[model samples]
Target: MTRIVVLGGTGYAGRHIVAEAVSRGHEVVAVSRSVPTDQVIGAEYVQGSALDVAPLAETLTAADAVVSALSPRGDMTDRALEALTNVAELLSGTSTRLGVVGGAGGSLIAPGGPRLFDQGFPEEYKHEAQVGIDSLAMLETTDSGLDWFFVHPAEVFGPWAEGERTGHYRDGGDVLVRDDEGKSYISGADFAVAVVDEIEQGNHHRERFTVGY
Candidate 1:
């Protein structure tokens, strides 16, 4: 089975990914600052901070892939990039692949021109969105040997609208995935499926992809 480590695994997106990976029989480790009151069965939860990567050396060493489900809010408002960079440096030459969960704001509105962030994005979310964009930039300029992939979720994805798992999703490369009605949405469970699918399939190396209905 694949060994996977998920930072911020107790959060909304991370918890879904952990549950999905564990259900698939993958060895999953959920790392966060605090343990979850309701933990996913078949998954190991660890109390850890992304800011300090040294303590996670042993765990990082054995991981097949490390997914950064980290968010840039609260105490991590401006430090998420630092945490991701540290992990990237630690996994630079190793065989472990680095997977990042980015925001929809960095997604392209069309095929070539404007990004969602470049348009009239909410001022409240601009900071966090900028962090996601910066994280992608850091990955692109990293050492050539590092295996990495970034994933951008649809415009409406969060705990507020936790939809059921339909086991289906469409990928929009560099562009936001929207349905015929011009709506971009993906259930958290299906988004997790996309992430784990990429882990098992190894598609889109060193690039970013989007997921939606």
Candidate 2:
């Protein structure tokens, strides 16, 4: 089984990713500030901030990959980037890969042009979206040399809809994924599938990929 660590594993998207990783029979270590309430059947929970480097390194040392699901609050984007850089530094010489959950703001709305957030995004979410965009920028310029992939979710993402695991979704490049009805969304479960699928298949290295229905 692939040994994996998921930073911020208690949040909405993180929880689903953790569950999906465990369901696929991978060994998982989930780290978050607060402990998770819902018990993931096969994951070891670690309580701590993603900013804690020493503990984060200790958790990542034996892992095959690290999934960063960290969502920065307020102006904590810098702090989040520092933590991610620390993790990348720690895994620099190893074979461990890093897969970050990127934001939709970074995804392209047109070919070689502006992003979604640049087109008058809602003020309420603009800050958070900027953080994700900044994180992706950091990943691109950093000299860590570790294998990394940024997975960007569509405009709408939420808890998994109650149903069988379909493992079906559309994947796209920098552009957003939209359907005929002019809707762009992906179920959390399906998003998790995309993330894990990338982890297993080893595609889209050092780049961002978008997902939707």
Give the local distance difference test score of model 2.
0.83
Per-residue CA lDDT of model 2 for 1-213, tens digit only, reads: 999889889877788899999999999999888786786988999887757778666778788899989877644555777777777777777888999997888888878868899888889888778878878887888665678899999888755443335799888788988888978788888899999999999978888899987
lDDT of each prediction vs. the true structure? 0.95, 0.83
Q: How far is candidate 1 from the true structure (C-alpha RMSD, Å)?
A: 0.7
Native-to-model Cα distance after best TM-score fit, residue 118 in candidate 2, in Å: 0.9
Per-residue alpha-carbon lDDT of model 1 for 1-213, expressed as tens digits?
A: 999999999988999999999999999999999997899989999888879999997898689999999999889988999999999999999999999999999999999958999999999889989999999999999987899999999999999989999999999999999999999999999999999999999998999999999
- Could you estimate the TM-score for every candidate? 0.99, 0.92
The alpha-carbon deviation from the true structure for residue 157 of candidate 2, after best TM-score superposition, in angstroms, is 1.2
